[model samples]
Target chain A: MAMEAYQAQFAAHLPKAGPAWLADLRQAAAARFSAAGLPDRKVEEWRYTNLKPVQEQLFALDTAPVGDTPPALLQDSHRLVFSNGVLQGSADDLPDGVRLAGMAETMAENPGLLAGHMGKLAQGQELPLPALNQALSRDGYVLAIDPGISVSRPIEILFLSDGGASYPRNLILAGAGAQATVVEHYLGLGGGGYFINAVTEVEAAAGAKLQRYKIQQDASGSSHIATLAGQLQDGARLENFDLNLGGQLVRSEIHMALQGVGAEAALNGVYLLRGKQHCDNAIQMDHAVGATNSQQDYRGILDDHAHAVFQGKITVRPDAQGIEGHQLNKTLLLSDEAEIDSKPELQILADDVKCSHGATAGELDETGLFYLRSRGIPEDEARQLLMTAFISETLAKIDSDAVRGIMERLVGEWMAA
Target chain B: MLEIKGLHADVDGKEILKGIDLSIGEGEVHAIMGPNGSGKSTLSYVLSGRDGYDVTAGTITYRGRDLSELSIEERAAEGIFLGFQYPVELPGVSSTTFLKTALNAVRRQRGQDELDAVQFMKRLRVHTKALNISDDMLRRGVNVGFSGGEKKRNEILQMALLEPHFAVLDETDSGLDIDALKVVAEGVNALRGPKRSMLVITHYQRLLDYIVPDYVHVLAHGRIARSGGKELALELEEKGYGAFVSGTEAA
Candidate 1:
């Protein structure tokens, strides 16, 4: 089907009971997605990741699966489970100041909850994936935290798929001085073919802190595309860690704008790919104000015929002085056929600002391997140990020991498989 | 016991170890000292089955078995340990983790039960304390950002932990102060037993002074030019390696 046909089909499925404003917004977003169409190699940002695989398949909107509980991996989390783009049930074991609300239920109770902030942070729909998500998303959450309150518990959102296309949207707002940890788990059940378009918007007020963890372990026959956009206020901090270890094709585009002074953003990730999987991560960091800091550290382990791509862009405006930004992407290739393409870009228009970017792609270090082998470690075990050490360097930066442990264990299981 | 007959080796297609013959019996400590570019390190690498150090000729027999037939790790599992001159700095791999993995691997190959975390730690602490390796250093990455003395001590720590029957120390005293050298020598000395053997290769006789060898051989042009008792080390230290080099060239 053509782009317009898919948009028309998607528009036909828009819920008829929504308010007029939401219906109008959906129509506009549908038209925008149709106009933009699917991005191709000609698009510089999408050059390394071709969207032909997505274009070749036409999927209908999925119906909510019945009585699906949270996956075992998320049993301990205070979570809202979404099955096939429909909010199921929510549980709250969090602290007093934290609030987790399902968008569908919240919107039904109070129509004006999303009035000012629904599409405010994610205004730009120039990309087709985000535009498509905006047109068809029917289930997500509106998680908020009160000012001066710290929630020690983690808020998790599980998006489970059952072999069809689903669009999930999440909006997170942290009030002044509030802090919380959020985890987004995208999983595909039944080993079926599916397409997931996820869009998330985060707003951190002054002095607020937010740690976001995104884990993607979809089915091998699925395609996942997620768009993450956020803004930080003065003295705010954001730590976003992405773990990509599944799906046949995956692309995560992140855009973070530091609009306030003394704001900091740390974006780190690890991708373990094997078989014929392809994972691409594109990040854009905008330091629009002075005294803002940002760091991007991403590492990957690519094996077999898998391919990984990382393209990071950090821009400092002319007035944003005293900014410190560092971007790096390192990958370890485990097989002769595996491939990686990394590009770290830094654009600094302001003087007196420090910025650096680097990209390294290499095989295992021979000397390190020999050193381990000389101590009686077999070649295979020695190689795995060195590769794990390479990745542990980045995982060590994660402040939460529990989350880091889970991620490391997942990497270990992947290696063993 | 170890035996080498007409051993010839090359690195990067260039011959480094020419025809050489030597033998060491059980409980023997043999020292091979030579000047720079005399293939002291090459001989150690060949014995340990390192990659790219081609043995174009000759044979190395360990306990009546062909050492050349074993892979690097196989040779290590078979009780051949090489203490590197420059210990590899492995970031994110704690010293404790490395030692445990190495110990467990050798134990598994030898049909012995592997030690758990607590057992491994108890064994590690003994040697570490003897070598003056701090608890903080044991928790840190292996050889990462360690001082020169600390690196040498860590190598000896490995030697003590593994307790290989045939040990090869390649210039283990190259970058160490007097105090650190004494600690390292003490660690090596503690491991000496009737069933163990060692080949300590170095350029200077200073290390030999601390860990006296049963026999000392002067290696020149990839061949052992002279062999004698412990008194030969004192003789060479007084006259320097120039006498041996000239004598080997003249022969």
Candidate 2:
């Protein structure tokens, strides 16, 4: 009865009019999500992170105005704000060669693009949360850059959650030889206990360079489940950076398919959690074609009773020879009660491939602490310095100076807190 | 500036510094020379308030304050510096940041305002230049990937910046070559003044020739078996530490 009640509520909010194809896709996704339900600890991919607390919450669709964006998320760039799955805020002024449109507007104006690329990279079938997101999401953005054009500035997307539940789907497509940077920042407003299920799909054409940064800082009471899936063509480069610094129940899955030769993927992230927070980061990098390179680095700092999970899997297919795949997950448990489950998986079916995965979980280096304390730094300050440095490895991989500086400051503030 | 009486310490439940007594006045530089396993490092660790070096029985009074009553950083705030024999490498903390933090912490503890970035940089430049340390070294992590001589020099640079009243240089010349030893000794000599005292711990007299100590004490079997002027270091070097290492002294 509870499931039926929730399903009826979701059905009431479905898009009234859309293309027949999209409607069918949404219906199929809803069926898939309803049949599977929430993933439990028994799921192999989500064995370490439990989602019962999130599933038990009765989250209705939210259609209210989210408050002003945080100053930290407001940088000098083309900004898009999506509040409660509704496109709002400033996106009027556009660059000369960049195109930005809401998913609904894009589908209505140019249905051919959506018909060709929508749901191609991320099908929402690999996991239940993404499927649920696909069924419930009402509005998102469609960003596309023209061929051979380089957008000099970053395009910032701010996702603000007001209350209840919101499902947002974003699609980024860079044409051949086009270069651009995009930032997806998630922020929670008011007393947040809502569930945010978001999915972002990206496609990079040949010789295109795309950098996407995702920052998830939800309210302590909120639950955030997000999936980022991208495909790279020949000679295409993709750099994805995710920073998880909030949310009580959070699981972020990033999947990339290197579909063509010379395609490169660099997926990196840093998660800092304290209190009873639980954050899980899963990365799947597939070298489907030959001569591809992929690097995955994720780090976590857990304090108090916080728990962190990092599962990074790199798969090199039979035709993916001459591939170089590297994945490393390092975690620092600040408190004795803190926990970490780091699983680095390497599936290699190809010959002449170089693949390595390493996972390390440990406390603060004692020698480093003593070195700092002996120089008159107090114990707490010393620990903070060490932890900051540990997280800096991931921060340093960020390509943008402004974003890196902001992230560094946020890390410092979190440490002091 | 520093006095120790009946100082007994243990490492992992094994006694190291046994009934050691020593004293150093203002402007004094005391050198404790001994061979391996003579408790030279244990004594330095005990004096610097390093954890796990339990002071089972003793009192270390520095400027009339009981050193045992202070934490490691508290002792550092009280103007006690210990130059580690094996300087630690802090991988991600730059040497410049380390020096600035240490200086500002000590200054703040002494009721002084923290130095701004410019002020700290200006002050650090003075010490780094005087210690023959390069600017590039300051930008790298503290002692990380540094040569043995560079590690020793960095330690002296910290000593110069902190300007402690009583410094214990535990084998400052252990890993240094001839030129590095000379440069490090010059840094120490420059810091010598009426308000400051130092304890130079070494096994050979090679270092004493450079930064000449005011008083030389031979530490054998965890106790001072001999005490004299700096010449005692040369005598022990000539005779070797055989007598001292055997738990019997020819003092």
Please, what are the lDDT tens digits per residue for candidate 2 over residues A190-215? 76888888889999999999989888
List per-prediction Cα lDDT, in the order shown.
0.87, 0.86
Worst lDDT run of 10 residues, candidate 1 chain B, spans B242-251
Q: Which candidate has the highest lDDT of all?
A: 1
lDDT of candidate 1 over B1-251, digit per residue (tens)? 89999999999999999999999999999999888888999998899888999999999999999998899988888999999999999998888899999999999988899999999989988888788889889889999889999998899888888889999999989889888888888888989899999999988889999999999999998888899998998888888888989744321
- Local error of candidate 2 at A28, Å? 1.0
Write down the TM-score of model 2's second chain. 0.96
What CA RMSD would you report for each candidate? 2.5, 2.4
DockQ of each: 0.82, 0.69
> Model 2 lDDT vs. the true structure?
0.86
RMSD in angstroms between candidate 2 and the native structure over all alpha carbons: 2.4
TM-score of chain A of each: 0.95, 0.95
Relative to the unseen true structure, what is the C-alpha lDDT of residue A199 in candidate 1, on a scale of 0 to 100? 87
